[model samples]
Target chain A: MIRRSVAVAAAKLTGGLSRRLGFGGGTALPGLVAERIDPEIVSDMAAQLGRGSVLVTGTNGKTTTARLLRGILRSSGLSPVANSAGSNMMRGIAAALAESATWTGDIRQRDRRIGVFEVDEATLPQAVSALRPRAIVFTNLFRDQLDRYGEVEYVGGIWRETIDGLDAKVTVILNADDPSLAALGRRAGLRTLFFGLEDESLAIEKLEHAADARWCSICGRELSYSAIYYGHLGHWRCEGCDTSRPGVEVGITSIETFPEALSLTVSLPNDQTAQFKLPLSGLYNAYNALAAAAAASALGATNHDIERGLRHASATFGRQERLTIEGRDVEVILAKNPAGLNEVLRTITNNGRSENIVFFLNDDIADGRDISWIWDVDFELLSGSLKNVTVSGIRAWDMALRLKYAGFDTFDRVELDTERALRKALTETPEGEPLIVVPTYTAMLDVREMLARWAGKKAFWQED
Target chain B: MAKKLRVAHLYPKLMNIYGDRGNILCLKRRCEERGLDFELDELSVGEKLKSDHYDLIFIGGAQDVDQRRVAGDLREVKGDALREAVENGVVVLAVCGGYQLMGRYYRTAEGAELPGVGLLDMWTIHPGEADKRFIGNIVVEWNGGTLVGFENHGGRTYLGDGARPLGKVVYGFGNNGEDAGEGAARAGVFGTYLHGSLLPKNPKFADHVIQAALSRRYEGIELDEIDDRVEEAAHAAAVQLAMGRSII
Candidate 1:
């Protein structure tokens, strides 16, 4: 106990020093240093939380879902510790857990504290054991970080094993629209709550190019889809087998998406319905809201509490976050994978105005070294009358090539430097027109810091 | 009207991983840009492959499950037709998983031997199961010009003595990590793991295939050169990226 206390104090000191030196977030460094002293520090620390933990994970929307859940939980008068910096590894979770702890290893707000975290898909099993979550939320999974995570089916395999090994008492929250995820509800004697979008009006006319899960997992035959929302999320049924879209306990039946916010009518499991005008934009956000509400409900949050909490939901930093700069509306949407980028493009195209945009692509370790996935995105949809596009970041040329092939004339607008690229894009945009800035994971961080500095907003780590 | 080129995109529904449909799209666009009648046929699993139907054939990469399924479909179903097409001197370009399937066999990391179509005298072996994929931007010296594309593959392909490589590796691990050879090329048949839509960055290579396919049906026909500035710029940028230089 004495050694663990000393280790925690040292970790906290490292984080403080790094932040003071402007090392950027310093969220993982403290936890990494602490783990060197005591490897089991996360499980040990999580043991102290009385309300236990609720884990949110998927290929995308984990960060957004966790943020919404955190807000909803807080509104219900429960204090929860969350990692809102978009960090999900063991180290980041530890940092967030340690921040709410004292130098003497005593957790702050012991009676009401809960751990609400977004975990990486590959690290879900390890995190589930360490956090010991009472409720696990499975958001929709798509083909993401292919070079890093291989195939989505591989991750699903891991998830099945992890789910099988979990405690029977732990509740499972799943997306019924996703066939692989919805199938998890059939696991023997496990408690599962399913959530999905039920409105066929929001269905896309045709499936995107990079969509996956076309074949039935059970029979390996073609799965017929009545409507595909995005990347295999929709009303689907396998003709060969009886498997199909399950009945959702919590569902979003209708959604009105706008440039500023989304209005949704959600059906909860208790046979009650709630209407919320969530301040977040896009159909994807509506799904996140439903997932958050379901997860919060599993933790005993009332329908009133969930609706009240969701009504106040906002973008989780760099996630469809809009800022007005000198009368120009610039929305920063994080695009890390084909599915995520397609959603952002759909949201932008929803306005039907030829969008002036900037795309930042990086090939750093965190961003997936293989940048070939850029081609997987169907960018031809943005060709209606795109005003202009500036491609930037470390792999700026690759992005520019991809856009050019996607039928966008970005040959004369490639900028390798992200800062200069933003300036150029901003300068070229007409007054009052929304300039969309689509960036990968690391690029989003850089763009966020740049925007935050100009607006005097707190850094991500500082805010969380 | 120009000469028609029948193009068969094999297993588009199942084997088009890593955005390889972009390659087919590029082929169609280039053919039409040059005033050629391009007919693209998508052959999925359980579909019969007509040996004489296509002038040029393209096969893309796939994931492990799809690859195994495709290998069986190739062996038990379309193997003879594909072999006949190859022997008939049809211009064919296969990438990554397609390249592996055209070989004698692919020995998986789990020690299972999946049969291949045996068009190329080669075999592939996976080095390890985790984090061993050869993935990155690659530059190759092929067809007397530079070709730049992205490669991500778990198996290392070894060419037998009778086969010839498509190019020498200017960068990245190609074929086997030690051979420094990229792919296998014989006559009008070509195979490589490079699929940044392989041909968009190398219009010359794309044209070479178009010309080869056209020549198979017609005599003394040369494709007119359209302005390749945009394609060349993108190509140069990729080449620069491969050579460890920024294309700002």
Candidate 2:
């Protein structure tokens, strides 16, 4: 008991000190310190959660999905303890758990509490063993950091192995459109619930050039797709085998995407159809909503709860944050990989019009040192109308060069500093034009801070 | 009259992990800007290559599994044609995985042996400490021009005595983290880990390849100049960033 108390106290001290020193939320460090003091601190706290845990993981959309699920849990009368800041690795999850637990290592909420964590794809196996989650949501996988996570096949293989070992009681919620996750769900041989886009017109004509998962996961044959919503995700079948998109229990049928809002006509389980208007933008966020709704429903969340949560869920930081600087519209969008970036570009260029773009690319540990992925993004989509683009962050010039080769004519100052670049981009933005700020993970944080300071808003970490 | 440039894109699907398609786009766009009609023939797995059909050929890099999958197919179908193209002075630019496969062989991080085209007398091995992956912005000086790109590789390539290096590394880790070299060049073949997809950031280098191929294909055909103000600025900014003169 004394050892556990001491560990909690140490975590609190370091976390408090970290915040007081203005070094940011020190959320991960405290947990790192506590884990060093008590090896099983996370597992200990996790064991006491009567409702168990829900683990959400993938190459993208983990944070937003977790946030959306948290709202559903709240509406379902369960207090969800979640890692909202996206420090998804073990240390980050531990920090969140330790902060929410009592000094004696007991969760304050006890039976009313449910743990929700967005584990990193590479670290999913470790987290699964530690949390022993009651339900796991398998979001679609895309090619992410090659240096850090190898490739899509490697990460998918690990997820498969981990899911194979999970007990039958552990419910698996997955995206039916994703071939990789669909194959895993099939292999699980359990009553897995699936969520996917049911709107046929929403399908893209052709897959992006950098699309991964072209080969069927079950057989070595190439996959034939009726529609590629984005990347290798959407309505695909293996010609060499009977592998294909599974039957979806929770599906999105009619999607009306707007600049600030999205309305999805969802077909729920038990012959229930509900209309939901989400405050989030982009088809990617719609997919996240479907995943969250399906997971929440699998965990016994009612349709009313799912609808309310979907309606109330707002954009998580850096996903599609909107700020007005002096009456000029500025949107902060995060793009970590080629697929995500292409989606962002497509979303921003929905009307086939170019918005003033500020690109923040960094090689910090979080941003993945290889800026080569920029070449994979379809910048040509915006080349015809893109007139003003300001490149910033560590690899600002790299992005500028990519835009240039994509045949974009205008190249603003390539500012190494994100703050200065943000100002230039906003100032240069034409009157009544929205400036889309696209940043990688670390650069997004920096740009968010600068924008928050400029607009007199609280930084994301400081938000309650 | 401007002559048409026929380019072969080797392994568009299997070996395009690092945005090698961008390299193809760069070549095509440059050719278009210079008033030359650019035709691209995309060859995938099991596709055969004919030497005389293309004036320029581009092969990209891939992940370990993809590299292994494509290497054998490359040897079976396109190996002899690739050798013939290089010998005929056709401009061939290979990056990262493409560069490694142009060598005699590549030993993967898992210690698997994958044979290369052996067009250049070089070999690559994943370092003893795999954690020492040479990644980040890199600057290399070659033929009086400074080239900048991002390199993420655990394989440390060493050139044999017969092979000449593309350039001396000005900043960041080069061919092997120890050697000051960055890429290998032999005859008309150029292999580098420079994948800001190489051509877009370095228009001059892109032009160098175009001119080399054009010079060999058509005599006394002058390439027209296109406006490159934006391209030049992008290149300068990349150089400044890579040289550490501009702190990000």
Candidate 3:
């Protein structure tokens, strides 16, 4: 107990010093310090939550889904603790718990506290062994950070191992539209609930070029899809083994995508229907909303609570975030993988067209050193839509080459410096026109910091 | 009149884990820019290769499961036709897993030997999971110039007397860390682990491939050069990055 108290105080002091020194958002540092002091810090703090915890993980939609679930839990009169700034590793979870705890290592509102965390794919196993949460929610999986995760199959293999080791009482929340994820849930023999989109009007005839999960997990044959919403997700079945997508307990019956919001009607598991307007847009967020709703239902939240939670949900930082910079309307969308980028392009092109856009690509460890995935992204979707396009970041020339091959005759400018590129893109945009900014993971952080400073807002860590 | 080239992409749906389709896009754009009528055919599982139909063939990387499945299909259905094409000087390019499957065999870390197409006199062995994979930005010296791309592979390959190395590694591990060798080449067939699509940045190498394909129909044909300023810049930047220097 004394060691835990000392660890908490040291972590809080380190985080305060980190923020005062302008080091970063102090998201992962405090957790690092706390772990060095107390190796069991995460497990120790997570145990104090009376309602246990729920883990959300996948390649994409983790942050958004966790944020929405936190809101829903809170709307249900429960206090939820989350890593809200998108720092999603074990250390980030530690920092979030540390920040919420008192110096004496006691959680505030101990009886009502529920740990809500969005963990990285590779870190999920360690997190599960530590937190031992009551429920695990998996969003769709795509080929992301190949250098780090090896491949999608490798991730799935680890997840299967993790699920097999879990207690039978733990509920597994899955996305039914993803064949591999659904298969994982089916084979786990644990309590499982599925959520998916049932709207055919939003389906595409063919799978996108970057779809990753097409093979059947049970039979190893190519799975055929009747309708592909995006990537390899949709109503799919294996011709070889005759295994198909599981029945969805919580499904979206209809969806309406607007420029700034998504209006969706969800059919809950209790035979109750809820209509809510999510302030976030795109079909990806719609999936996140569905996953959150299903997980909330498993956590004993009511339909009214789910509806109100989703209705009041807002965008996480750097994810469909809208800002007015220098009197120019700018929207920052974080895209790191081929499937994610394709969805972003589809959403932007489908709703409203932007004349000026800036693309940032970085090869930092967080962004995956292999930038070849850019070729897999169907940038041809925006072939002739833009009047001015600026490319920047560490691999600006590579992006420029990609655009050239995509039939863009020329670029407005290719700037390696992100700040300069963002400034130039904003200046080139005509008044009253929106400027779209697409950046990788690390590039998004840099751009977000600059934008926050310009907007006279506090740093992300200081926001809440 | 425009000259025509037929390219066959092998196992496009199954073996395309990396950005392998980018190589096809690069080839098509380069051919179209130079007034060559480009035709592409995708050959997946259970698909056979037609004799005298294609001038060039491409196969990309895949995971272990997909690679094992493709190995069976390749040896059973398309082995003889592919060997005949190679003997006839048809240009072939295979990256990563494709490169492993074209060799004699691949010994997995678990002691199982998966047979290859035997197109090259090379074999690969995965030294178990305890060993580190050769993965990073790579720079190589090939054809009197520098070739820069990214390589990620767990199997370490060694070439035999039947094949010559494609290049000497200048930086990063290639083929195997014990050897300075990168890839293998013989009779118009080239195999490597480099998968920065391996063509977009290396325009000179791309031209070499194009020239080799065009030579099949038109002997001593000289190809016109499109502006490659962006391609060259990207290549140099990658090389600089591999050399541990800042690229700006």
Candidate 4:
């Protein structure tokens, strides 16, 4: 107990020092320091949450779903401790827990606290063992950071192993529309609940090039989809073995995507329905909301609480996060992988109001050194719609080349420096029009920092 | 009327990992930009390859499991056709896993040998799970020009005496990393681990592929150079990045 107390104090001190030194978020460092001092820091702190933890994980929408779940938990009168800034590794969870704990390693109001963590796909196994969450929500998986995660199936393999090791009491909330997740839920013996989109209006005619998990897990044969709602996600069934998507407990009956928000009518498990307007757009967010609702409901949040929570839920950082810069609305959307980029493009163009857009493509380690995924994105979707396009970051020329190949003859500007590109993009935007900024993971962080500073707001890590 | 180039994309659905479809898109866009008709045919598992039908054949990389499935189909169904096409000097481009499958055989880390199509006289051996995979931005010297792309592979390939190296490694790991040889090339078939979609940034190499494919039907046709300033800039930037960052 003394050692644990010392570890907590050291971690808090390290976090404060790092924040003061502007070391960028101090999200993972304090946890690293704490773990070195006491290896049992995560399990120790997570045990204090009487309501237990709920882990949200997947390749995409983990942050947003976890944020929404946190909102739902809060609405249900439960105080949730979360790694809210999207630092989702084991150390990030440790940092969030360490920050919540007192110097003596005791969590104040322990019975009321619930750990709401968005864990990384690669770190899910470690997180599950350490946090021992009461519920786990999986958003749809897509090919993301291939250099780090290898392949999508590799992630699925790890997830299967993790789920197989989980206790039977732990609830598993899955996206039934995602064939891979649906298959996982079917195989996993734990208490599982599924959420899916039943609206055929949001379905695409064919699977996009970026779709992964096309093969049925049970039979190893190609699964046929009745409707593909973006990437390999929809009503699917295997012809080889007759395996198919499980019946969804929480399903989106209808989704109406607006210019700035999405109106959804979600059908709950017991024929009860919850209709709410989420202050976010796109079918991806709709999936996130469904995942959140199912997980929250499983964790004992009422239908009214779910509706109220979703209605008041705002955008997570760097994900459709809107900012006002000089009276122009600048929305920053993070587009790291092909599927995510495709969805972002679809959402932005669906409104048909976006004229000025900026793309920042970085090849940093965090952004996956291979920028080849950009080619998989259907940049041709923005062929004639954009009035001005600015390409920036380390691989700005690569993006420019991609846009050129996509049939864009000329770009408004190609700037390597992000700040300069952001300035140029904002300046070129006509008054009263919105400027959409799509950046990779690291690029999004840099852009968000610059935007936050410009908007006279705190840095992402410092905010809440 | 523009001349037509028929392209056969093998296992486009299964073997299309790591943005490899970008290579096909690059080829198609370049052909269209040159006022040539680009015709594409996608062939997947259980599908037989049509001999002498395609001017160019493209096979991208895939996951390990999918690669295993493709290897079986490639050997039983399309092996003879592919080998005959290679012998007939059909322009072929294979990246990463596709390149491995075109070799004589690939020995797994667990020592199980999987037979390949043997279109290229080479073999690959995955040096166990403990050893690091060759992954990152790679720069190579090919055809008296610089070729830049990203390579991520666990298997180390060794070229037999019958095969020739595609390029010399300038930066990053290539082939077995010890040999500094990157990829294998013989006749019109080019097999490499470079998957920055290989052709989009390296427009000259893409043109070489187009030229080789067109020569079979058009005979000594010279491809008109389109504006490649953006491509060249991207290539230069990648080369610079590869040099700046030491990726083993």
Highest DockQ: give the candidate number. Answer: 4
> Per-residue lDDT of A265-298 in model 1, one digit per residue for the tens?
9998768998978776677888888999999988
- Please provide, for model 4 over A1-464, each residue's C-alpha lDDT reduced to its tens digit, 9 standing for 90 to 100: 88888888988999999989888888889989999999999998888899999999988899888888888888888899999889889888888888999888999998899999999999999999988989889898899888887677789999999988889999999988888888778653579998999998878888898999999887889989888888888999999999888888999999887887888999997899999888788899889989999998999889999998887665342333688899889999888789988988988898885579999999888888889899899988887788888999888888998888877754446888889999999999988899999899899988999998898877777665
* Native contacts present in candidate 2, fraction: 0.72
- Would you list the C-alpha lDDT of every candidate in the order shown? 0.84, 0.82, 0.88, 0.88
In model 3, how large is the Cα lDDT of residue B72? 88
- The clash count for each model shown is 1, 0, 0, 0
Error of 4 at A343 (Å): 0.5
Alpha carbon deviation, residue A361, candidate 2 (Å): 2.0
Grade the docking of candidate 1: medium
Q: Count clashing pairs, candidate 4.
A: 0
lDDT by residue for model 2 (B88-136), tens: 7788888898899999999987788899999988999985444677877
**Better model by lDDT: candidate 1 vs candidate 2:** 1
TM-score of each: 0.96, 0.93, 0.98, 0.98
Model 2 TM-score on a 0 to 1 scale:
0.93
Runs with alpha carbons beyond 4 Å of true place in candidate 4: A315-320, A410-412
The DockQ assigned to candidate 3 is 0.72
lDDT string for model 2 (A281-356, tens) is: 7899889988998998999988998898777655342333777787777788888999888887887788443558
Instruction: Provide the clash count, candidate 2.
Output: 0
True contacts kept of each: 0.41, 0.72, 0.65, 0.78
Clashing pairs in 2: none
Q: Model 3, which residues run further than 4 Å from truth?
A: A315-320, A410-412, B245-248
Model 2: per-residue Cα lDDT at residue A333: 82
